[model samples]
Target: MTEKVLIIDDDTNLLSGIQRQFRNKFDISVAEGGEKALDMVRSEGPFAVVICDMRMPGMHGVEVLGSLKEHAPDTVRMMLTGNADQLTAIEAINEGNIFRFFTKPCPSDVLAKGIEAGLEQYRLVTAEKELLRKTLAGSVMVLTDVLSMIDTDIFGKSTRLRDWARLLAGHLKLPQPWILDLSVMLSRIGWVAIPAEVREKFKSGESLSKKENEMIQRIPETGKKWISHIPRLEPVAEIVFYQNKGFDGSGFPDDEIAGKDIPLESRVLKVLNDLAGISQDTAPTKLDFRQLDLQAQLYDPEIVQIVRQSLPKADAENRDLYFETAEVPLNLLIAGYELLSDIETKDGKLILAKHQQLTKTLLTKLRNIGEIQGIKEPIRVRKHIVRKV
Candidate 1:
């Protein structure tokens, strides 16, 4: 990727001279004043670095750079000024988060070094964000994949929720959709502590003992505890912690954080979690939001409206995949095919839940379980080659 640079100044001569002098050394774009520069940043940006003259006709450097801080926050901002007073430096640093301040007669070589430094800073900022976005999220995903081996149903539901979360978020044009996606995927991480029988009873809609109910109620906080320990996942942890919070402020943690004061992603998850519950009781293709509509006080109306429109479409998309399924025996089982029904023993004990994708770990578990308990032959599955879920 090119490390594109933008230089903003009112002097056409200076702009042209700078462009010419460093055109070979850097990728350069120039704007005569702040307004035009902002327009460029909005329309053609992801600029690696921006250097601006301190004083101009309108939208002085501090103001322009402050705006840039909002628009292209990752871009390294630097200033060149004839008035290099302490007050100017303080204001620039406070407002613009300037990377470097240069005096008016900055040598070409010195300016070159500063710009290079700014570019390096930009690279570090972006690279760290990418690591957090990809690598950190990846590590979290591996943990969830382990969850799949433990409880296929929870993992399967989370996977399904991710489909809806991404779809609804896209239709609504929400920023940072990945945050919502991660929240949905990790929504059930709290269930890791619950004994298999307790989780099963809860899933089967069996009434739980008071102690069991308390354990179940703590799932979100448990999720928050495990996830919050990771660096920079605190927002995701907050969303996980608040997934069960009611839009009308009637749910747990016993706080007054009602309505939109609840995190928006949590609101999105609240609606989606209820929808996943409803889907559990019905056909995936007929997944309904009307039940959620009746409980409007518990959800964000906007998110419910979008889910009502988008979820059936997401379900319909996978209907064809189910239509082309196959039933394979234990010896023939392979990774990447999705289970369409629960895998059980010859004696009729449930071994793995339905809607789970076969993984090497799962396949090994099935085979070992087969050797010991004898798996039922011809397990029903769909060939899952599309690389989703």
Candidate 2:
């Protein structure tokens, strides 16, 4: 596919000459005036470059250049003028974002070089933007994975945190570099600093000692330390640090900053965090004393009331299953697929396929060869067959 080049000019001879010069190098498109040029830009751009001639009838080159900038800002703008006067150059720079300014009869080599440079610039800018987007996405994914390892208990609990954060950001009309609900996500990264024994203790319904409790309280500081190296993640770190603080200036690190002073994202995070905590341990069951204890202690009273009022009755609908059981060992099968798939018996040693699925199944078979094992109920496995992509 050839790159389409649009040349806008009223002078027919000049247009023909320029078109001929680069006809072999480009797939060319042309328009005679500003309105037509704008139409071409709207309909056919993402052109690599747009070259316009100054001193045309009706709308001047600068005006056309400005319109091009507005319509297709990424399309590099080059001005061709008979005069290289100070005012015209300044106006082209300020108003047109001119990529390269050329006096009339621009040398072919110079114009070619400028065109090449402009295209390269466009590619670099585009690549840089794409890389940044991927980087941000990768960072979020890394954060999610880290959180998963930190506390598998709450790993998938905050599924809707990002959606709620985006919604709250829109409602609060957050500015660019939006700062909102990262507090909830990064909040649990502090759990990494906590000993596994502490987590196990919680699972076993044991309370932490006073010193252990104090150490747990400082977990957010650990999170801040870890994320401080990432400049873009720093704002999220700040929000994570203050997640325990309340909306009414009643909670930790006493600054008495209430209401809006509490970043909207942090406030949203606090609500979502409570919602997730309740969802994980209490789903499929009605709210009980434990849920109430968390609500009263961990959440803003107004926010809690809002959640209760807004709680959808449809949510009471039961899901298929909550926990993995032998009857639903399909998830484990998916994880251990490679291990179960291949196995070889050697002298007192077994070599399984790099695939685990076959190995897992064989192990299960040998372990329960005569006695009933994993026989309570059979699990359903869904398999799809498709041609190779």
Candidate 3:
């Protein structure tokens, strides 16, 4: 495949000459000035290399290439200028992260060689990024899948927490929401360390002894330990470490960090985790918002307000529909549906509670429960109707 090259020069004649020289060797694009170059970079970019003339009207080549570093870092950058002073070269390299620096009267062969090098750099950078992305994705999938197999209950909780976190993050227009989503999914990973009996007892809402409570408090730390070893998961580990932190610095792993000192992602997770707990009681009510507010410093006030304002609209968007257990397709049991009543085993042990969102994991667990312990027929669920805008 041919690599694309962009050449930006204020001198129209020079631009035309460069394009004509390289057009046959590569897919060449020409831009008359820095502004036009930037526009092309943004709109028709992912170019293998960009060659810019240093002196231009309105944004200089240094500034243009710097913007490209932010907008398209994988695109290799080169600067051409008649002024080849040491300071100019240093500034170009430092600010624009230029891969190559050439004088205005550079020979065609030298420029071509530079473009070849730049293309190679672009390929290497993009390939590394793609590899990192796939590795991270696969690692997360394996961990979450294992968590799901080990304990569906915890997996179900993570799914709900992720849903709430995603919704709240989207509301706030938080950047890189996938990080928050992944953090929430693995937030309960520490539970794997707890003994099965203790885990079950905790899930059942039974009173825990002092030792048991202490063990529970250490869960986040355990999660941090588990995740810290994974490459590129440093931020995720920190968020998991502080997931139980309070707005007032009152929660576990008691530290001086409080208020905005806590990572924004951690604070968001804390709010969503608490909200998920509240929501499990049934769909949250106005009173529930009041209760959350009354908790005093447990959550960020701004986030709490956002949640309060969002709930009514969320509720309005969802209308209730019912379906029998056998008739309900697995795909239909989507996120945000509430259970009208307890889904219980034949022995009357509650499997899933009323008003809990019917996540895919939960639905699979429900089906497994039906196959294993057996459930009563005509299982009823309150499906949330998403109204068309």
Q: Write the per-residue lDDT of candidate 2 for residues 1-389, one digit (tens) a residue.
A: 34566788888888888889878776667789778888877667778788887788889989999988776776788888887899999998999999889887789989878877877887877687667656765665566654553444544344345544554454444543234544555666777777889876865679989988787777767877886777677777877777766776666556777766775556656776655544532221245324655546445565555445444321323211222213233234443222212222323222322211222334344335224322221233222234345
Candidate 3 least-lDDT 10 residues: 316-325
For lDDT, candidate 2 versus 3, the one ahead is 3
Candidate 3 Cα deviation (angstroms), residue 82? 3.6
Candidate 1 residues 235-297, lDDT tens each?
Answer: 999999999999999886679998889999999888878777766522333335566667789
List clashing residue pairs in candidate 3: none
Query: Candidate 2: which stretches are off by over 4 Å?
Result: 1-130, 163-184, 202-205, 280-328, 331-389
For all candidates in order, the CA lDDT equals 0.84, 0.61, 0.78
As a whole number from 0 to 100, the lDDT of residue 73 in candidate 3 is 74
Cα lDDT tens digits, model 3, 146-208, are 576566566656655665666677687764566787788778889989998998899899999
- Best-fitting candidate, scored by lDDT: 1
How does model 3 score by TM-score?
A: 0.70
Q: After superposition, how far is residue 14 of candidate 3 from its true place, in Å?
A: 9.4
> TM-score: which candidate is best?
1
